[model samples]
Target: MGQGRLPARLGLACCLLLLLLGGSGGLGSRGMPRGPWEEEQGPVAEGGPWGRARYEAVKKHLRAVGALSKQYWQYLACKVWQEGCEEEEEEEEEKESSPSPGLEADLNEQLHGQHLAKEVVVRAVQGFLQSPQPQKALVLSFHGWSGTGKNFVARMLASHLYRHGLKSKCVRVFISLFHFPYHKYVDSYKAQLKKQISETVQLCKQSLFIFDEAEKLHFSLLDAIKPFMGRYDNKGQVDYRRSIFLFLSNLGGNTINEVALDFWRAGRAREEISMEFLEQRLRLELLEPAENSYAHSHLLEENLIDFFVPFLPLEYHHVKLCARDAFLARGLPYTEAALDEVARMMVFVPKEEKLFSAQGCKSVSQRINYFLP
Candidate 1:
């Protein structure tokens, strides 16, 4: 409130305060009421300086409070009441919002996302959806280290199906998340998975079986579904012929060696790897020693390639191509050069089959975006 030029010491103090305020991460602490929105209202109807600030502050606070509240509720319902609280409110909510016992809705909801392998995924999903009645549907999705768009794409593909009139209640997608140490009932594992499928068949009368990050589940589980991988009649009690099976995997190919070599050249030896080694690693990570033989034998015998399969051979390429088209269709700024580079990187190379796996499309796109300069 004093005149700025009245005292040299006071003036110097003001200058110092301004300098401190201008420094990095200095002005936004809790005690400071000033904010970026302190000058005007946002795009919302009630817009003003203090009003916008208050509104934004309220929203931020509400979001934080909401997250805390959610954690509190989860604790109360799962951790707390799971210890045996029979409260009526929790009971009512349980009835209203609890996931379906068969987990059809839960699984379908999880699968609804922008699946990276859009073409193959879309085709497989559509076949599953359009099957006359009681068709078995299967999807297998995999992701790379520090990569999540693969899962997001899976979700989007599922959303597309729903928008086109696919009902969640009628579809069952089994998605496996990250690998965790869990006891495998070797003898009953297949039976258990089949039982879940059987229950879905009985309840929905038709089902879409999905495996998310399938590489993480016991190999026995993958082997168990071999019979239903291709177009076929429902093996379950239900008479459904339109069942679909699909796998989306992020497993690297021989190009992983190149990536590893590049890393080594750049002085990061820890990441060197090969496709065969990766597949073997994934196999070991998922299946117990006892179950390995059964799973490996079944996979080879059934002919379900570790890669996406389409009604036609060339169609496999469509997975990556169609995804690029979709990205451009959605205004993601895909240029011809980009497309050509992707195709060249993925298809043109004679040894591509042995070199790069799905990462040729996904990992390459990511690196292209990151190192544009």
Candidate 2:
């Protein structure tokens, strides 16, 4: 009985030992638990530490793939929308840049008296439109007496160059007396002026800046614009080359008329009076100081202006032409007698000679009503 009991106990111990060995080395080819029940149930059980870690790693990988796919689709959608938006913006810009048919005809018909002035304006505008990347700003200085079509030509240019005409967002007109009244505060004014110009040019590369009554502006104020008007080696923050700067003043009116009158007295045709003659004399007059004149300004001394376009004084025939156009604009009867009467109403200078229109059809609109009614 004792021997049989001993064998049973020994057998029981051996069974226990075998069970421990099998539990320790029951790994599959991939080092996971291996058994029919374990394979079916999976290595990661719901409550165990190893089970939770394995489950979380699989979830994180799936989440990463989903995020990547979402980002890819969003990028593709944004690219498609951006391309369409860019095409629309380009088309709109092209349409705005083009000139209107009526604008061309009006400019040709309304801007009379000075044939050279018309040619210069037309050529400059054409050049500006045709250029893809201008190296310098188009700085045009219109010098003439009152009502000699200086302002009229500028208005016509603004109308043709921009879609909304003078009211366009890219067009900025600064009057000397109105915009910059405090000449005593030169430093503050200069800083403000530069800031406005820099900001405007940054916003729109093809901007138009009109300086009206420029002669009345301080000489220092005009000098502030020298850098923008001239060419530069480094273009800096804003490329002002594509912009247009127009200065309208009565600075060289007398010089222009004297040249014209001299040519007339010499019995030479108006066409013979070359631009070289006008430019040289005008430059001299502008550089020399005179009472109530812009001659002292560095703008002339530095020769920063690209074109010094002279609006020649209007003759009797030119005023008559202006009257006829005004009548037509008002939808009134066009009569030769009415046109002649309008021309006769204007006050001409040099009573002895009575050569050209002193007012240059400036009061034509007002005088037209006198003849019409």
- Model 2: weakest 10-residue lDDT segment is 16-25
Candidate 1 lDDT score relative to the true structure: 0.44
User: What local lDDT does model 2 show for residue 277?
Assistant: 79
lDDT of 2 by residue, 129-237 (tens): 6788777888899998888998888888888877987887678899989988886887898999998888777666577899999988888888887888888657487
Candidate 1 lDDT by residue in tens digits, 1-373: 2465447644554565444333322244454444344434455635433555566865775576556655545544454235334354345423332222322333333322222233344444555455555323353434343232454444554444433222354345555543322536644767777776666555443345556555556666666756555445544455434444445443432332334335445775332333344445444443443433324445544544433321111112433564465555456766666655554554322253442233333454453453244
Per-prediction count of colliding residue pairs? 31, 0
**What does each candidate score in C-alpha RMSD?**
18.5, 22.6
RMSD of 1: 18.5
Q: Assess the local accuracy of residue 326 in candidate 1 as a C-alpha lDDT between 0 and 100.
A: 52
